[model samples]
Target chain A: MSETVLYDYWRSSASYRVRIALNLIGESYRSVPVDLLARAHRAPEHLGRNPQGLVPVLDIDGERFTQSLAIIEYLAETRPESGLLPGVAVGRQRVRALSHAIAMDIHPVCNLGVVAHVTAVAENGEAARRAWMQKFIGEGLAAFERMLDHPATGAFCHGEAPTMADICLVPQVYNARRWEVDLSACPRIVAIEARCAAIDAFARAHPDRSK
Target chain B: MSETVLYDYWRSSASYRVRIALNLIGESYRSVPVDLLARAHRAPEHLGRNPQGLVPVLDIDGERFTQSLAIIEYLAETRPESGLLPGVAVGRQRVRALSHAIAMDIHPVCNLGVVAHVTAVAENGEAARRAWMQKFIGEGLAAFERMLDHPATGAFCHGEAPTMADICLVPQVYNARRWEVDLSACPRIVAIEARCAAIDAFARAHPDRSK
Candidate 1:
């Protein structure tokens, strides 16, 4: 692939997920920051690339891609040797389910846009937003921990290796922490997050280290 | 598949998506309702089947599957002739992106749980919630329309054949209408919805027609 460019935001959980995927796959790519605070993401050119106006849009191999999970799936499908997803159909389905338990159920609800909307309407915006995050994110993780109770969950969400599940896991943990949601009830998730954090790919992809 | 069972709720957009998938593939599955309004999804037995406490859990070949998209993908992969996804790599990614633009971006924000939470926190709760649905659902469809602007789109989200994009699209339009979100700006989406509504599989899977 020639000239792979990822339009990223330093701290967007969605972008962070993609960064970890790229790092784990051992692919070198350039990052251009789209500052959400400065409204860079709302610019017409960026919207032209991704009409959703969401971050972590990847342009690679002469094509533009949106949606972090979809981008990671594309990478995994094209680079099976990277082991982003398991080979078996059932295994892939399990990983995708675990991934969606976070991506679909948690992340989208507490997204910045949603938070902004909540803030615009909520009377006690700060407390309400924090409570909202804590309730949904914490509950979602509790359910996720239950999902990890399955025999297939090992060091990572799927097996011993980090599959697409872990790619989603780390960023969500970051968001939970960012929002100050309690994770004491989710020992399995905490343990898996620790395992992912120990890896250089996930460690370096941390939003704190990003430009 | 000895006996296929779908634990479904009649009005759930997610469950509705799976019903369409099952119908399109000519898969006969018994439907068992899990009433979200009664909080049956939170019961222990249902929780055992899906820790996420979400609907549209499919039981096939003695295995349980959750997450509508994952289940659809699983069915498509294990039953490729069903053609739920496109044949090529880029095509599959595009379909997934389109699907997520609804499944993730639009649906979760407008979900009953999230909206209930929004109402509990927000002032002028009803109006705020309505605006929330209208704004996000409207913008999401507009972006989805832009996605359809590609050469690949035909009668459905991708080519003349109904793929996962169409599967997700039909229900989301159902939701937008249910919420009274205007579709005047989304001609492509409206056009696609009209086409999908005319088809037997999609028509059969409509929430209004569900048992």
Candidate 2:
């Protein structure tokens, strides 16, 4: 057995965050793919491991940790040298604010649950669903664009280094693009996503790239 | 003028999260209330502070930090003695994950935007709003109940000490109760909210009690 095993679904943004963090930290781990589309996350064994029935549970050294940002921070704190967070307290907060901007503000509203809700009640089927997605994904990406335009934003969401913010941002941008939201409006976000995609750590963690 | 000023609305759950953290850390600051109902968050000044136009922007030592969880974690880190996060790496991750369970998973879907969306589209009006609120709130609180019922839960969401998780939870529970969501199913969450409310920090920072 590997020292770490990640209970993850290939398309899950939460799981993608952990996968990128692990690669950045250079930690070797086994991937246990939990098929979310098939309701694998709600299975009895997975529920026992995580009562929340969420994917991206990181089994680290026999203990399980859930939540992508938390898992990433744990790796950063334990490894220290991987430098996912800046050394200074203020800088760390900035990084975290950017990360939460996507995780808390953007992703939650556009998740499978919200989409399903829109589809259930919306009048025109595909058009209404697409409108709902566009409104949220567009507004969220616009806000994220403003965040990236801040002087603190460099080659990455934070400074030149890749942090938890970048991990969350890339998956979100990918998802937004998948929904056919225009990226031309948010050049900063587009640039950052491109920068992140070029890296092996982020590239290797792409949903299609993962098993 | 205080070095830090918090842009908050008294009744906003997001702002309430930050207020509890500031009170817990015993930080002296100024409060700049942004009226959510009046659409003050959309104003240029507020939007400048947080492009997302959300409340609970912490203008700390001249730097502005947006997002409730981000601001709370910032305060916890800067004021280590507040004991908002655990000392060990794994413990910290668990605390953060529990906290994010509410912040990212629960709050966003039930907040103003989604509510407005439901109100705009749902033919059932008030009933639809309530249903939307209850569905997201139920899922979130049920997941939170499982986390709280874990062996790690003590008087608060985490250990005996109130951490970031409690800071996020109490406000959400308060909002849920405001909407008249049934709490009978979430004994653990209700119990933890009671434990947290008894403390002066949480009590004083309540929406009705704030300036």
Candidate 3:
């Protein structure tokens, strides 16, 4: 095994998803914290590594990989013994869709960058920012809750074990809670989050646990 | 072969992505147009198919699949003859990451719902909405341009043949251009889009070509 280094920010929900996936897969990786608040991602050094300037860039054996869901799927495929994804094609698609619903639909709407963009233009300042965050997060999460009603959902987001969907879900839930968006309407989501939190892998991968 | 019915809106970039994939695979499917302007997606029938109330739901043998990328990947896997993804693990991950770089990172930020939210709050009207759209679309397309600089980018988003990445990129670029975001900064993306557009499969699947 080669040295694995993850460029990440503690509070980035995308970074957090990758962290959970790595932890679940039992891969040992060093963390290089990127300060999102300081906009370190846009710096030249980070840009050279990832032109998109996004965190959770996984460096494995000197090769760099970006995109949290893609990194997690890479780990699942490369380290098949960890079994982060199902073997069957349809099953994999289902899991991927569930993961993407959270990654694409939910997380992107309330990201810090988007919120900041809204605040930059809105007349109401912080209140406007908060409102913008709440509206998107609320709608996205409610849609996710409806998705959870699928028969595939079990203790985790899919089936009984932790899969990529769970990896994506827990972090988004954490971020939503941080923003004070109520999750009471999403019982299935709240339940799954609790199940994920109980796992040692998820417990160790929480944002506050990292340096 | 089982009947596959696709519920899609003609103008939806996400739906356009799925159409490209379907054409690439040469799959015969019925198209059920959902009117976004009339909120047809939010109707009881469509809501049951996809609780997210989104378009591009691919119903195969009574089971409906939501999310454009997921449906595309599922089709690719089930109909392996088309081989939309690479055979090797690393190459597959690269393609997926590239697809996600656009699908997750770019599309959601400038989505119709988010833009509507911005306009509703703006009170300053169409100018504010356009500004909000331009800001996100510009940043995202520029970032996407950076991602395209990698050697992996060929005539398409991945290798010579159009894959999921190209499926995602063409529609996004089309949307960005519709919003009048300058594409001069992304010559690579423009080149890729031109290649994709030249293909009969992509041309037939384009938004303007759809019923």
Compared with the true structure, all predictions reach lDDT values of 0.91, 0.86, 0.86
Off by over 4 Å in 3: none
Q: In model 3, how large is the Cα lDDT of residue A62?
A: 62
- Candidate 1, residue A8: the lDDT equals 98
Q: Which candidate leads in DockQ?
A: 1
- Chain B TM-scores, listed for every candidate in order, come to 0.97, 0.95, 0.95
Residue B89 CA error for candidate 3 (Å)? 1.6
DockQ versus reference, model 3: 0.77
Estimate, for each residue in A62-175, the C-alpha lDDT of model 2 and write its tens digit: 678888898888888888899899898888898888888889888888888777886776666577778877888888889888878778888888889898889889999888
Ranked candidates (lDDT, high to low):
1, 2, 3
How far residue B162's Cα lies from its native spot in candidate 2, in Å, is 1.0
With a 3 Å backbone cut-off (N, CA, C), the pairs that clash in candidate 1 are none
